[model samples]
Structure formats: C-alpha cells, structure tokens
Target: MSLMSDIIAKAKARRMRIALPEGSDERTLRAARILTDGQIAEIILLGQPDKLNAQAKTLGFTLDGIEIVEPVTSAAYETYVDEYVQLRQHKGMTRKEALEVMKDTVFFAAMMVRNGIAHGAVSGAANTTAHVMRAGIQCVGVAEGFKTVSSFFMMILPEFRGEHHVPYFFADAALVPNPDASQLADIAIATADNWKALVGTDPNVAMLSFSTKGSATHPDVDKVIEATQLIHARRPDLNVDGELQFDAAVIPSIGERKSPGSPVAGHANVLIFPDLDAGNIAYKITQRFGKAEAIGPFVQGLNRSFNDLSRGCSTEDIVNTVAVAAVISQAQA
Candidate 1:
C-alpha cells in the first residue's frame, strides 16, 4: 500500500478523535464527510451547527455521524477561557484576552486538544500558517526536550531510472525561515522522530549542504557541520551524516566515492536542508518537475497533536492531514 493509504488504515484502526477548526470551509466539510464515511476517525468540527449543516446540505453531502460544536455556546467555553488565561498568565494574558481568543475556531480547536476533549486538531485551510501555528504553540505547547516546532513533507517519488519507488521526508520546509545550528539540530531530531513514528522504520538522516565532506568551506557549510555534530552528541543512536551534497546523499555511486562507509550517505531517508530557502524550493521543485507526490508540511515537536494545512489544500489533503494527526496522537499516547 502507499504510505498515505497505510496512514488512513492506521487511523481507522486507532479511531481517535480529531477536531477540525475550519468547518465553514467547503473543503473541510467534504473532508469531514470522507473521514466519517471511511471510519478513519471520530471527527469533531468547530463552528456554528446550523451554518455547517446548511453548508453540508448545499454541498450535497450528509454529516451524519460528525459532531459539530459551536465553540462560544459550548459548556466548556468559559472553562477553556479561564484555563487559557492561566496557561498564558506568565505572559500577562488576562481573562479578557483569553475570552476573545477562544472565540476563534482555531484556538478553540487547539484548546480542545489541550483539555483532552480531542486527541488532535487540524487547521490552516482558510487560515494563515502563522495564525494556525500561533494557536498550536500557545494552546498545545512544545513537547518536552524540544526547543523548536518544525515541519516535514513526506515525498513519494515515482519509480525512475530503473529504481523502485520509495518515500522520503524533507524537513523544515514550511516553517523556520532561517535556523541557526542549534535550531537546525532540533529540526533534524524532530523530523527523524516523526518519520520513524509514521513510517515504522529507522531513520537515516542526511544533513544537506552544497559542499561534500569539506570539499569547500564557508559559514553555511560550517553551520551544517555543527548541526550534524550536535545531533550526534544528543542522539548518538541516530544514523546521521552531514556536509553532503544532494547527489552524494541520494546517489549510491557518488555517495561511495565521496563519503564512503558513512551510514547515511547514499541511503538517507530523511533529508534535512540547511534552511527554509533550500527546503521549500526543493520540495516544490520535486513536486512540480519531478512528478513526486508530496503529502505534507506536517507540523512536529508539539506536545499534543496539532497540524497545519496549505491555504490552497484540497479535500483529500485535509483528509490525509487528519489521518496523520490521528496517527501521531496514537503514537504520542
């Protein structure tokens, strides 16, 4: 089975509760219908019940088993507001601010995850990434031992040049515009952990740079080298190598010639780019020109499961993200 199909199957088996904050969006409603019909997860949509129902009717679908919650009218609304104030009180957030923030569907959905009302939350369909991520970071918080919350794209490549197809993960593609060595290390570790959780395989991480094994020298190459060292010091068990060019990281003959006997070189399943400039451009190029199927910019390193979607995402994209969040929830639990 394809990786996404496997994820959906896993989600169905787990049957976790996932919340959608953008119930007013047509794509989200359609995705909710698909999730319910397939028994992927118990979907809780946050919005006005009447408006959501009318929208579903206009879209010619039934939200038969889906639960719709009007956030402001729900019994937990005031409680959530109070708790949010406490959570952010150190930042000088008052109940007044918390009340207004809780009215937003994204924050409400994240609060649901925070309070265990739902196992996970997915948004960003009609919201900006910054807004969705702000809600996630503020409400769900970062995982223990993680200093950075990052993202990865699961790239499914087509069989080409007589090689069989396989899935690879590209990291920090949609978040963290520019990362220093420390943050880059955190990104690598987070991506590797999530890759293993979802793919059920050991991660071979290759930290990408323009120069291979000190063939050239620059601050950019130095940053990648330092990040690689930090990853080794922190996670020695991880199979990781760094300061490798793109070809050396993926191509067997070139890898042997350049970085011989390196565990990750030539066999890397998780590619950690130096910066967002490289990662975002590379993933898009691979998707458009290489004809690879890219599934995510899946958010990682959150204590609770909260994912973001592209603003232009399709209904299938939303369904897949919800499935991913469900699997992450199960794994975290």
Candidate 2:
C-alpha cells in the first residue's frame, strides 16, 4: 500500500482530534467534511457556527459530524484569556491584550491544543506562516528536550530503484535561517525523529554541505562538520554523517567513491541543509523542477502536533495535511 494510504488508515483507526481554525474557507470546510465522512478524525471547526454553516451550505458541504466553536462566544473564552495572560505575562501581556490576541483564530486554536481540548491543530491556509507559527510556538511550545522549533519538508520523490525508500525528508527549509552548531544538531535529531514517526523508517541522516569529507575547505563546510560531530557526540545511536555533497548523499556509487566506509553515505533519506537559504531553495527546486511532492514545512520540535498549510493549498492538500497531523498527534500521545 502507498505510504499516505497507510497513514490515513492508521489515522482513521486512532480517531485523533484535530482543530482547524480556517472554518470559512471552502478548502478547509471541504477537508473537514472529508475527514468527518471518512472517520479519520474528530474535527473541530473554529469559527461562528452560523457563519460556518452558511459557508458550508454555499459550498455544498455537510458539517454534520464537525464541532464548530466561536472563540468569542464559547464558554472557554474567559479561561483561555486568563491562561494566555499568565503564559505571556512575563513578556508584559495584560489581560486586555491577551484577550484581543486570543480572538485570532490561530491563537484560539492554539489555546485549545494547549488546554488539551484537541490533540493537535492545523492552520496557515487562511493566514501567513508567521502568524500561524507564532501562535503554535507561544502556546503549545517545543518539546522539552529541544531548544527551538524547526521544520522539515517530507519529500515524496520520483521512483528510483535501489536500497532506499521512495520518500525522503529535507530539514530547516522554512525555519531557522542560520543555525549554529547546537541548533543544527538539534534540527538533525528532531528531523530524524519526525521522519521515523511519520515515515516509519530508521532515518539515515545526511548533513549536507558543498563539500564531501574534506574534499573542499570553507567556513560553511567547517560549520557542517562541527554540527555533524555534535550530533555524533549527542546522539551516537542515530545513523548520521555530514559535510557531504548532494550527490554523495543520494547516489550510491558516488557516495561510495567519495565518503567510503560511512554507513549514511548514499543511503540517506533525511537531508539536513547547512542553512535556511540552501534548504529552502533545494526543496523548492525539487518540488517545482524535479516533480516531487513536498508535503510539509511540518513544524517539528513542538510538544504537540501542529502543522501549517501552504496559502495556495487545495482542498486535497488540506485533507492530507490534517491526516498527517492526526498521525503525529497519535505518536505524541
């Protein structure tokens, strides 16, 4: 069976709760309907019930199995405001300011996930990446062991025969512009864990750079080498190697010739770019020119599951993202 097929099937069995804040968008409503009808999740739609119902009817969507919540009118509104004020008080947030921020759908949904009203939340369909990310970072926060939040693009590549699987992962493509050695190591660890959780494979991580095993010399190459050493020191059990070129990371023959005797060379499924510039450009180029499916920018290192969608995403994109989030929520639980 397909990877997505297996994930969706597992999600249906788990019956995870996923809150979606963009209730007025047709794509979101359509995805909620699909998830509800498929019994894939317990769908909570965040918006005014009457407005959502009207939007659904106009779009010919049935929300019979969905729960609609308007943050302004819900019973949890006051409690959520109080909680937010406390959570952000050290940053000088007043009750009034907190209340105002809570009215934003993304913040409201984040509060829901924080308070355990939902297993996870998905947004970014009707909002900017910054807004969605800020809400998740502030409210739900990163998992305990991680220092900061990061992202990964789950790249479903074209069929290639060999030892590795069809899908792969690329890290820090949408967050952490220029990570230091520590952050880079954490990003590798987090991406590796996420790949194992979502893709169900023991990740062989390739810390990518412009050089291959000291073949070239640059500060940039040194950074990757240092980060690779950090990962090895911190997570010796993880299968990872670094300072490798793209070809050396993915091409078996080239990898063998370039970085001989390394376990992760050529067989790597997780590629960690040295910086956000390289990571972002690589994933986009692969997505557009290489005809690969980039299913993320999935927010990693978070304590709870929360995913962002592309602003131009279709209804099917929303559905697939929600399904993936549901699976992650189950794993976190």
Candidate 3:
C-alpha cells in the first residue's frame, strides 16, 4: 500500500483522539468530518460551538456527532491558564496574560495533549509555524530526555525494484536550519525512533554528505561525521553510518564501490541531511523531479503529539497531517 493509505489504516487501528484547534477554518472542519466519518479518530474541535455549527452549515457540511468546544469557555480553561503560568512562570507571565494566551486554539490544543484529554493535536492552518511551535514547546515540550525538536518528510517513491521499495523519510527538511554536531545527532536518533514506530521498519540511518567516508574533507562533511560518531556511541544498537554521498547511501552499485561493508550504506530508509539548506532543497527536488509523494513535514521529538501544518495546505493535507499526528500518538502508546 501507499504510505498515506498505510498511515490512514494505522491511524484507524489506533483509534486515537485528535484535537483540531482551527475548527472555524473550512478546511479543518471538513477534515474533521472526514476523520470522524471514517472512524479514524475521535475529532474534537476547539471553537465556539454555535459559530462552528453555523459555519459548517454555510459550508454545506454536517458536523453531526463532531464536538465543538470553545477554549475560553471550557471548564478546564482556568486550570489550563494556571498550569501555563507555572510552565512559563520563569518568563514573568501574569495570570491575566496567561488567560489570554490560553484562549489561543494552538495553546488550548497543546494543553489538551499535555493533560491527556487528547492524544495529539493538528494546527498551523491559520497560524504561523513559529506560533504553533511555541505553543507546543511551552505546553507539550519535547520528548523525554531529548533536547532538539526536528521534522521529517515521508517520501514515498515509485518502486525501486520489485519488492524492496519501502518509503524513504527525509529529515530536518522543514525545521532546524543549521544544526551543530550534537543537535544533528539528536535529529538522527529522533528520526530513527519515529521511523521504527510509524513506518514499522528497522531504521537504517544515513547521515548524508557530499563526500563518502573520508574521500573528501570540509567542515560540513566533518559535522556529519561527528554526528555519525555520536549516534554510534550513544545508540550502538541502531544501524547507522554517515558522511556518505547520496549515490552511496541508496544505490548498491555506488555503495559497494565506495563504502563497502557498511551496514546502512545503500540500504538506508531514513536519511538525515547535514543542514536545512541541503535537506529542504533536496526534498523539493525529489518531489518535483523524482515524482515522489511527500507525505509530511511532521514536527518530531515532542513528548506528546502536536504538529504544524503548512498554511498552504488543503483539506486533504490537513487530513493527512492529522493522521500523522495520530500515528505519532500510536508510537507513544
């Protein structure tokens, strides 16, 4: 099955609760209907109930059993604000300021995940990436014992061979512009763990570079090499190698010719780019020229599930992103 189909199936099997913070948005409301009708998730919309209903009617949609909730009016609203005050007390936030911030749908949805009221949240349709991420970091925080928060794009390519073409995941493409050695290592580890959970495959991590092994030398190549060493030292059980060129990382002929005897070379299903410039450019090229289907820009490394969607996303994109967040919840479970 295609990655998205597999993702939908996985999400339905999990039957998690997904919080939609932008219920007033036509696309999100519609996506919630699809998720609810398909029985994939228990859809909870954060908005004014009456306005949500009226908006749905105007859009020719029937909300049916879908639930609409306004964050400011919720019984848990005060509790959330108090918690936020404590969470950000170091910032010198006042109760009054906290209350106003809590009213934001992004913060509300993230608090829901923090409180276990929802398994995950999907937002950023009507918000910027910065705002959504700030809410998540302040409320949900990063996964336990991890320092960096990164992202990945699940790239499903056309069959490479008969039966060996599993989907590939590209990492740090949409977040963390220029990572140092330690941060890069954290991203690789997070990507590997995420892949094992959502993709259901043993992760073979490839830390990408323009030079294979020590064939060439540059500061950028050194960073990948250092990240590789860090990952190997920290996670000995994970199969990974780095400072490898693109051709050596995926193609057997090139891999054997250059970096033979490496476990991950030519067999990598998860690729970690050296920096955002390379990763963002490479994934776009793959999507456009290679005709690969890119399924995510999922924010990874959160303790609970919360994701930022592209403001340019469609209703279908929102649906897929919700499924991705649900899948992340399943991994935690």
Candidate 4:
C-alpha cells in the first residue's frame, strides 16, 4: 500500500487523542468536527468552552463529542500548573514566574499531553515555529534517546495522466536551516521514526547530496557521508546510506552503479537532504512544478506533537497537519 493509505489504516485502527490549541480558528474547528464525527479520535480543543462553541456555531462547524478544555478554568488546571512548576524548578523561578511562562495556549496544551490528559498536542498553524518547539521541549520532553526535535514535509503528489505517484516525505526543511553532520543524523533518525509511525513501513533512509558514492566531490557531500555514518553508528538497525545524488537514492539502476552495496540505494522511502536549501527547494519543486500535493512541514522530534504552518497555509494544509499530529500521537501512545 502507499504510505498515505498505510497512514489512514493506522489512524483508523487506533483512535488518538489530539489536542488542538487555539481551537477557535476556523480550520481547527472544522478539523475537530471531522475527527470527532469520523471516529478518528477524541479531539480536545484547548480554549474557553463557550467561545469555542459560539465560534463553531458561527463557522457552521459541528463539533459533536469533541472535548473542550480551558486551562484557566479546567478542574485539572492545578495539575498542569504543578507539573509546569516542577519542569521549570531548575530555572530559579518561583511558582508565579513559572505560571506566567506557561500561560501561553500552546504551553498549556503541551502540558495536557505531558501529564497524559491528551495523547499529543498540535499547534503552530497560528503561532511561530520557535514558540511551538519551546513549548513542546519544556512540556512533553522529547522521545526517549532523542536529543533534538527535527521536522519534515510529507508530500502527497497528485495523480497525473491517469497514474498516481507515491507520496514522498522530506526532512528538516522548515526548522533547521543548515544542519551539521550530527544534526543531520538526528534528522535522519527522527524522520525514520516518523515514517515508521505515519507510514507504518520500516523506512529506508537516504542521505542525499550532489555527490554519489564519490562520483562527485564537495564539502557538503562530505557532510552527507559523515552524517550517514553517524546515523548508522547511532541506529544500526535502521536501513540508511548517503553521499548519493537524488537519482541515485531513488533509481535502482543509478543507485546500483553508484553505491552498489548500500542498504538504502534506490530503495529509500525517506530522503534526507544535506541542508535546508536542498530540502525546501526539492519539495516545493515537487509540489509546484511536479504537481505534487504537499501535506507537511510536520515538526517532529519535539517532546510533544507540535507542527508549523508556512504562514501561507490553507484549510487543507491545516487538516493534513492535524491528521499527521494524530498519527504521531497514536504512535507515541
């Protein structure tokens, strides 16, 4: 099955609790309605209950059976506050100072997930990327053994001329602008983990550069090679290889000729670029010129589930991101 189909299957098999912070937005309201009514999961919308309901009515969105929580007035507020205090105790801040920092809607939403009130938290469509990451790191506290929060873009390409191409996911475009070898290794591992969860396939990770098995030479290409080795050292069980060009990564013939014995050669489902410039450009080209429908810029590796928007996001973008967040929440659960 295709990756997206596999994702849909996984989501259907398990109902994941997705906490939508800033639930008053039109897109969030619509997603909440769809998720709840479609039996996707329990969507806990974080905001004032009355305001959410009133906005739902105004937007003509039905939010049947979707849970609503206002951290300010929730019966569980004290629990969240206490957790926040504990997490921030090392900062030399008093309880009041900590409370002030955690007052942001995203922070509270993440607290809900951290404390097991929800499975995962989704924000950043209405907030900045840095803010969402900070809240997640402080609250959910990264997955076991994951030191950094990396991210990726999942592209659902459109069917063209009666043939549908497989969905492709690319990594670390929106967050880390220029990743070093170690950071690239983190990106590879995180992307692999996300691929396993969202796509339910043991992903073959390919570290891509302009060079292919020493066929070309560049400092950046060396970085990809080093990153590939680091990822192997860290996660030997993962199928990965690098210092390959894009064609070598995906085309069996080229890959065989270039990197004959590499595990991910010509079979990589997850492509990790050497830097942000390549990742951002490749996905956009695939979307705009290649006519692919892009799903994310889904932020991964955070302590909790928090995604970012392009600041140019549409309603469909919002819907897909929420679905991605739901998948992540389910996987972690």
**lDDT: the better of candidates 3 and 4:** 3
After superposition, the stretches of candidate 4 with alpha carbons farther than 4 Å from their true spots are 1-6, 159-163
User: Sorted by TM-score, highest first, which candidate order results?
Assistant: 3, 1, 2, 4
Which of 1 and 4 is ahead in lDDT? 1
**Candidate scoring better on lDDT of 2 and 3:** 3
Please give the TM-score that candidate 1 achieves against the real structure: 0.96
lDDT of each: 0.93, 0.90, 0.90, 0.79
Across 1-333, the per-residue lDDT of candidate 2 in tens digits comes to 667777899899889999999998888999999999999899999998998998898887668979999999999999999999999989999998988998988999999998889999989889998898889989998788789789998887676654233788899999899998889998999999878877787999999999999999999999999999999998898999988999999998999999999899989999999999999999999989978888877888888998888999998888888888998888889
Tens digits of per-residue lDDT, candidate 1, 238-301, equal 9999989999999888999999998888888899999999999999999999999998989998
Q: Cα RMSD for candidate 3? A: 1.3
Clashing pairs in 3: none
Candidate 4: C-alpha lDDT: 0.79
* Per-residue alpha-carbon lDDT of candidate 4 for residues 121-208, written as tens digits (9 for 90 to 100): 7776688777878888878887776666777888766663254767667997777889998889999999998888887779998899
Sort the candidates on lDDT, descending order.
Answer: 1, 3, 2, 4
Clash pairs (backbone) in predicted model 4: 142-303
Among all windows of ten consecutive residues in candidate 2, which has the lowest summed lDDT? 157-166
Candidate 3 lDDT tens digits, 89-145: 999999999999999998999999999999999999899999999999999998886
Tell me each candidate's TM-score.
0.96, 0.95, 0.97, 0.91
